[model samples]
Target: MTALALSHPAVALLLPLALLPLLRTSATPQAYPSLEPLGGDPLSAVFSWLLRLAGTVAIAALILGIGGLHLKGQTITKTGEGAHIVLLIDRSSSMDNNFAGRAPAGGEESKSAAARRLIKDFILAREHDLVGVAAFSTSPMHVLPLTDHKPALLAAVDAMDRPGLAFTNVGRGLALSLDIHERDTSAAARAILLVSDGAAVIDRKVQETLRAAFAKRKMNLYWLFLRTAGTRGISEAPPEGEPDTPQAFPERHLDLFFKTLGTNYKAFEAENSAAVAEAIAEISKLERNPITYVENTPRSDLTGYAYGLALLCMLLLALAKAAEVRIPRGSPA
Candidate 1:
């Protein structure tokens, strides 16, 4: 329900002036020596009352117009086919390199640039999804909150290509992405798309907290691992001589950690930009679900309508005055 409101409510203090028209008539008065033979005419009495009512209406409308009447803003719930998604992007300095682990040259695009382009296309395809963006290097940066606003989401994606810090703080970034989802109370399918060319060992304490959070909230998790040429993959096992540890193979261990969380997790190892695009397409196909979201409608102004009504009433009063009968001086009483 929408409620009526006023911009200048103080102007309503003068509303009592509308009653003045009812107290007195605008017609000229005629003198009479006696009242015995002069009887009230029914038609004249009705017409006089109508004119007073019109005058009252005009005054009341004018007061309301000055007060600046309007309807308050509203929030409407809508059903749509989309999920609540958070894009957790890696912004470490390594993302600036091409898939071959070198500076992009001769029309080659960096990993960050490819991710931005493909993510923007994904956003545009899901017209109804509420999306948020976050980036991680040495720390997590909250780029945007969950919203269905497309322009802002695209702008946030555009900022992901900026020069980044040295470290890949994956654990904190995941925590921030989960927090963004937690704050949104809407009933919808939840998913997190983590895009990175590499990973770092998560702290034990952070891993426990993430496990607890994941256990509490069931959501889809997708990792788009942009693997460079000759680099280790997420599922690759270490060589025989090297000890199997998170420090030696962080990507493989991170993938293992996600699997242990009991959420629906999938990892896509993309060797190039085309592979990344295909992985994003698969994720899009997987996340289609019914969602309930709230959309806000801005307030509407009714000042012009109020003034129009006042003008209508004044026009009626003017016509009544022109048709009024006048008694000449010294006419019979």
Candidate 2:
């Protein structure tokens, strides 16, 4: 239930003025020989009391209106088909290149640009999802907290395509994303949407921490690998002569690490914008689960309603006055 509040509590001090109508009579003074003749006039008594009541209501309502009545803001829990998603975006310098691994020219779109466009669309399509955004290059940067606010989410997605740093620090980025999820206590379907064009070897200690974190929380992990031409894919084996190590084959090793985390993990290798869109659509389809999210309602003003009641009461009083019969001093009672 919404709670009632007043903007100016001092104005409520005038509420006692409403009692004046009951204490004092509004009828004009008239001279009469005796009160015995009107002793059984119950109908007239009822009408008289009704007018006083109307006056009291008008005064009280006006006072409340002046006091600025309103309903306090409230947060409500709502159930819907959505997930708590953290968009872990890559902001490496190489992300600015196209799928062919060159700077965007003519109609070609950079990997970051395509990711931004598709992710924004994905966010809009999931109306009830609680989304947070984080970007990582040299370090993980928390862009936005988990929220259902669409405008802020769109703004965060728009900022992802900005010029990026030199390194792709995926370990710290995943840790930050896990921390974001940890801060939220909502019991909803949780997922991490990792968008990156390249991979970096995570430190051994950081990898242990990530493994522990992933084990503690059962979450869906999605890696949207924007693969450039002639580059290694997540599942591609190293060349016959090359050693198969994390340093030599980071993407494949990262995929192997995610699989070992024992969570629902999937990797999508998109070579262009269309492929990225298709992958996003698939992820959107997989993350559909019943979720209970919090929705906040802002404070609502009730001053106008109070004033409207006062006006209604005044109109009743006006009608009563118009219907009243005036008896002259010398006229028969």
Candidate 3:
């Protein structure tokens, strides 16, 4: 279906001017003294008509182009299951190690590499979900924003290329991820999937701010803990002496903190790539419940087509003039 729209609709009021060419009168008299001879030749008469018609068409096409015509169409895009997921990833040095709790050598797959592959897979499975990604070490770095464009999302995931600072600032990572959500006011389903093998203490004020955001937006938070072998996971309780500190059992303490946020929260602990995949698969199932969303198809400009048609008409007009048979004024030389 094709529809034409003018960028400058006001210019369309001048479209009547295109007809001025039809009323064209020669500023100078034609070489032929009278039109009586022109009528005797059928081909000559047809050529005159052809030339005028082509001129009219070229003028019309040019007018339309000046008016900025655009072909508009409607595309009914179904926004699949509504979930805006922001991947809050950890970029600490530990992420450079493999799932077997060993440091990666050249060309070896590390925790970050495996996580990236699995996350890319997860995105492929959730075709409708708008996802963003962020990475944190000393501070949070926003790698991507909430977008459903698969290539951009995958590229952003791949960009977590090297090990970051040794410190993990989960607070700043969470703050940045939530800020991405706040940027979009839509009430569509929201979730934050935090993938990290470590945790750090969050500031008290930031924690309060995060809790408010969680409650107001009614966000679902899932922590995918990629545990290193022999390290305490989310299920582990803090040591008796360091229960008050988040440093001793950082993952578990953070898990507890998440549970108190008064919004939907869950934690999944994974020690291997397979386990991480399984955790993402489980989250996939839980978030599949349908929610309404709107998709937009951008308008397309078609002035090039108009311009091309105009060019064709001008070429035909030139050819007709070139093939014209003109009578000799005096003697045939």
Using lDDT as the measure, the top candidate is 2
Per residue, candidate 3 scores C-alpha lDDT tens digits across 220-298 of 9999988887877776666577655776666767888898999889888888888888998999988875655555566
lDDT of 1 by residue, 1-333 (tens): 979988999998999999988998766676646656879788878988988998898898899889998998898988877899999999999999999999999899998899889999999999778999998999999989998899999998898888888999999999999999999987789999999999999999999999999998989999999999788888989988999999989999999999999999999999898999999999999988988877789999988998999999889888977877675769765
Q: Candidate 2 — which residues are off by over 4 angstroms?
A: 2-14, 28-44, 65-78, 294-308, 323-333
In order, what lDDT does every prediction score?
Answer: 0.91, 0.92, 0.80
**Where in model 1 is the C-alpha error above 4 Å?**
7-17, 24-37, 63-68, 71-73, 297-304, 328-333
TM-score of each: 0.88, 0.87, 0.76
| Error in Å for residue 116 of model 1 | 1.0
TM-score of 3: 0.76
lDDT of 2 by residue, 1-333 (tens): 969888999998899999999987566666757788667788988988988998999999999889999998898988888899999999999999989999999998989999999999999999889999999999999999998889999998898788889999999999999999999987888999999998999999999999999999989999999999887788988889999999988999999999999999999999989999999999999999998877888999999999999999889889987876676678765
Clashes of each: 0, 0, 0
**Model 3 spans > 4 angstroms off:** 1-20, 25-54, 62-77, 106-108, 238-244, 291-333
Report how far off residue 166 is in candidate 3 (Å): 1.8
